[model samples]
Target: MDKAARKAILRELREQERARWWATLGLTSAQLDALHEHILANLIDCCSGELELSEQWANQVGVDWSRLEQALMELGGYCDCEVEANVCPD
Candidate 1:
């Protein structure tokens, strides 16, 4: 394949992977972005050593906390700072 075709294929694969990641967290891309921003801002002080900020963001945005938290933990995001660092779009 030409370079353009190869690039297109790679782009499509990335989109698919991003979609799956968000789906696993029961969130859309926008929701995840919002959550990330929230955590980033709140984490200026420090990580609460738990998912406190993430849960607050979920409640504020009407996201399913149980599903989101489970998915985050599975992805190695056990706290606000961890969520910002580990759980994010590609």
Candidate 2:
């Protein structure tokens, strides 16, 4: 994907994650900021093939790459492999 396309996808992904966090726990703006940072770092790693995923972080937001990838793919994006998960264990 081009830079613009990649940026847009990341933006969408971040917004989706933000919405989930907001609805689930009503996180503060600062918390949202941190969450965005975490998401971006993980996203970069995944994209670059490093694949350094943090299950703790994933659990915090209630979704993983696999789940996010599914959501993105359903929205017409391409996913090359499995990601973490979207749901956390109860």
Specify the highest-lDDT model's number: 1
Worst 10 residues of 2 by lDDT: 81-90
Query: Where does candidate 1 stray beyond 4 Å?
Result: 86-90
Clashing pairs in 1: none
For all predicted structures, in order, the TM-scores are: 0.81, 0.29
**Clash count list over all predictions:** 0, 3
lDDT of 2: 0.48
How much lDDT does each candidate structure score? 0.85, 0.48
True-vs-predicted CA distance for residue 49, candidate 2, Å: 36
Task: Estimate, for each residue in 15-79, the C-alpha lDDT of model 1 and write its tens digit.
Answer: 99888888789888888889889888777566767999999999998888998899999888888
C-alpha lDDT (0 to 100) for residue 80 of candidate 2: 21
